[model samples]
Target: MVVAACAAALLAGLTGTAHAVDNLPPDQPLVEDLQSGGKPCATGDDTVYVPTPPRLSAVLYDPEEDNQPSESSPLSGEFEAWWTDADGTVQRRDYSTITLSSGSRQYWTMPSDLPADTVISWHVRANDGHATSPWSDDGNGSVCSFVYDDTNPEQPTISSPEYPTPDEVFWVDGVGVYGHFTVDSPSDDVVSYTYGFLGGPYGTVTAERPGAAVTIPYLPLTSGPKNLTVRAIDRSGRSSSQAQYDFNVKSGRAPVARWKLDDPAGSRSAAAETGTPARAGIGATFGGPAPTGTASTTTVALDGSGHGFLTPDTSATDIRDTFAVSAWVRPAETGRTMTVASQDAVGQPGFTLGLHAQESGALWSFAIGGARLSGGAPETGEWAHLLGLYDAETGKAHLYVNGHEVGDAVAATPAEAAGAFQIGRARGTTGYRDRWHGDVSDVQVHDRVVVPTEVSEHAWRKPTLLGHWSLSSATDGASPEQSGGTPLHLAGGASVYRASDDSCIPDIDPDCTYVPPPLVGDGHLALDGESGYASAEGPVVDTGDSFTIGVVVRLADSAPAHPMTVLSQAGEHTDAFKVRYDPPTNSWQLVMPERDEAGAPERVVSQITGADGGEGPGQRLVVVYDDGTDTIKLFLDGYTNADATASLPDGWHSSGALQIGRGTVGDGWGEYLHGDVDEVQAYAGALRDEDVLGLGGETNPCLC
Candidate 1:
């Protein structure tokens, strides 16, 4: 009846827009997704085991055609959520219907003052600047309805790993980091634990009973760093707040030449590795000091008004055919001509690397080139990594920003012979004599060519680094390389961070925190078509019956070429009922079979779905059969598409073991499902269309 009432309101235009279907719904704004716990109703259609008036989520989307407007639309729009009160009257909730266009995941829940154990039926509608969509309906043409479960489980205490722990960096051993946890609850019901690396939506373990020590098994790890977070969930579906652990998997390489860049003023220099006497000097007045809080590194700014740069002492071996140049830079302002580093000889044998602005101040233009090769313009950013490499043996030049290769690079013009090296400004000898205006730090140079992997490894500051300039702290104008080989003196007074940092916060501590967030990955479970199955005892619904099945399925191909089964149950081929998907027509059928006189099973009554195929992907599809109406219907997303009369006959009893992802006939398996089917659920009673809508979004609670 609630479903019928919701459909009546929709068809009567309660949500505002209504369009005929011989085709698709009219192009209008609509709620693309709505759900709870970032998941669907895990228990069944009408009841969500979780507590509260219940948290509701809705994401709005506009017709693709109307999205790119010439004139900007209103920044925020109105969203209305109305519900039926216990007194049998329709009332609107007090939650604000307003949200900005840039807003994400609008949410609403029953007021804290509301009583629990009450049956609530609610519907939602979204209004873009232009118009409102039809009252939001689940694919079943009804609003979201559920009985509230307000009592939450006991708060679980995390016992392992030990809190108040500082950050650490290291490689993953065979045994990945381990976490052990336990939850204690008063109810006899079992509790489950969900853990993930990073922010999350993926559950490493969906439902595991609580134990004295709950630990996550190790899996192949990703290349970069990660944080791990975990939470506890009781049988009532309530989840405890999470505990976080921060750490990184980084390389351990020794740098060649180090420059603690902490020189305040006087003479600025970069020392050569091999103990060569050649060092760096101040070309002009050093300026532009960047204040970084993390490691409190040294920073200096230079204006393009003059040829401000560092004069390098010559060492043929240290400045040879192969080169790896890297640094951390932050532009004070963009769009102006700026050069950060260069080694230009009197002839065309050397190279010059610099930043350029596009047509506007906001855009960036980066390029690097030698006599014969050039590549890459980095994306404009306040702070970014800049890397330039040239290998004479390979005759190739490469440019990179943030570890990603930038354009197609060409041959390098052997940079071996004796030459002058400069920083912050290019050599005045070149035609492109550009002075830089920005902050620069941690300049490193290697005499040998490093591979791409090696370069990426350095992105996190790996080992065996040749020449390094940490550009950190110094007593007066003197700053020695961290390796202590080359010592340089600062000429112009440069402002920089003087505070020491904790060694535990390793790598580059740009954004360091006591407890960082965890790293998360894709959370979907892939099922192999042949062997995947989840089975359970189903609710009994005899002769007078009402059953509903809501599915979120993905096709195995662009167009499924074979039939696949979703749910089924059978006994000796005499008692059977199943749901089949036909690829040819992109149709869903709720089929019931009976044994004929020939002793073979034959189709008795089948309600074929009129829903079209390739509605794109991740669309919620529902098949509902209500004995009261003697009919079965198809609902897509949340709209009723078609219906069939008498999908079930008299004395239809479906009391048997339920098998998902495949069907069994005569004790043999057939009609196995391919592709993925998530949040597949069934209900003994009818479900409202709106309830189906809330279950449409993909659940990834741990995605960060």
Candidate 2:
């Protein structure tokens, strides 16, 4: 009988009519509805913004184990879930008694009584009649997690020292008033504030922590009544009620005519911040970097090619006695006299304020007809603040470079050469001589001679130096700061050596390549690849605000196995910012973390491939965070890399020591540099392109 049954089964299998039994267990359950709007409700970091009374859902999976059609078609199963509430109380729910079908979804609504700001961690598993599947997780062994926050942050309070109250008028001294606004919030969860002037687009300012006051710089475009509104935002992306602030801005002593030169490109006219506008002739181009503040976006570029000049209206020509002319200028060439601002006279200029080429170098000068007073060597292709003052009462013409007087005032009689007020060229025995060959911005003409204090104020727009290390020498295991009190202490056999000679005159030498050359200074600090670095007891720079950091580095290994940091500042869990060479991408990187916490996402901007001259020789690296533009710019060898620039509208403060030659990795220190480091500098404000160029050219940025 057994042999006959076996023969019958073999015949059935041969005929393709054998019965097959399903005996496999179900696959792991895939939770459904865990995401809202295509974004996962549970996140790896922080809470996800969601509606109240969150619902948990999942899709059950089962492998049919029975041969019967009815039992396998709609496979019955049960799901089990466990969760831990914010208060650390663990709870569970079992849907074993309730019937469920495979490949179908089920949901469990969270209790309405769950407290606000409650964080819930949960996991789910599926079980068939015979077997159970593994529990679902976030792939890293941790249970899925999310926060239940529905409360909004409290309203923010706004105040300003320049404009205290809405009911009163605040008198400002200049056309560009940098009004300082302080914003504070009562809620501890507030992380940032949104603010803007009435009828204007809003801007965001991130706070260092909860309840910490944030100071925002505002430049009023016009002088009149102004209204500003601010709203606090919490970590969960909830905004509070708005707070309104009102104030009036009035110029105390307005200029007779002030040409800001911020007009659109190709426009024939440059708008005046105070009075009549100036007309741009053929060769003048727009959109050059402004000399100072964010209020002035661009300056006019004069190539010294052909009839390039800016002529103001007749209002500026009325300055005959006790007049002052001041403008920020960056000279492209300095071998000959270049007139920045001048008024036409019969045979000569009424007054000329610009660079006068001397045997020693180009000197800042103020000249009247036959007399000229010149002092202080002004570098070519670098911005300089020039002011010419003619005080008729004193019968002297004063010249100032930067904010200080240069040479002794020269006695010169007044000349009534009230013709046309011209910028970029002056009239001499020859027609239109000494035309300017560079950028000009913020031209102002005052009817009365401005005092020394006012001249100082006009010339003082350079960034404040937080710390500067020339790295020329190391004494007693420390590198002394050139401009500040903080010093960097050397460690792990780091030592100083004379820097290599680089004979490249910027914008002059034909052989000079655009790539930054080797270190030009006296000496530089050398480090071993294994363990060598320098550190300071500081958060030397306020990373949360607009600031600049720069260094000249030459890597020992062109293709290192890992990233090599040139400079960094440690935060609580990571480096707030790092200027480093990353090997994987073979590029120089400017790295900043999205948050200060550990495992946070990083914002990396990179440029200049390692094989393309980023290694071997010393290269100038500069990073700038401009809060006004909401941008982080990376500069390689005095040249900006457009691809390596990004919009970082918010910043988190890093309150730790400034480190050189090493960066933070996880909970320990790593990314040590194997190279030479020199001319490390930190500034409290964003520096202009000309300023950065001056640094790379070995010019003192302070101009002291």
Best-matching candidate per TM-score: 2
Model 2 TM-score is 0.36
Q: Which run of 10 residues does model 2 get worst, by summed lDDT? A: 30-39
Compared with the true structure, the alpha-carbon lDDT of candidate 1 equals 0.48
Clashes of each: 56, 1
- In model 1, what is the error at residue 146, expressed in angstroms? 86
Q: Candidate 1's error at 499, in angstroms?
A: 48
| C-alpha TM-score for every candidate | 0.29, 0.36
lDDT of 2: 0.74
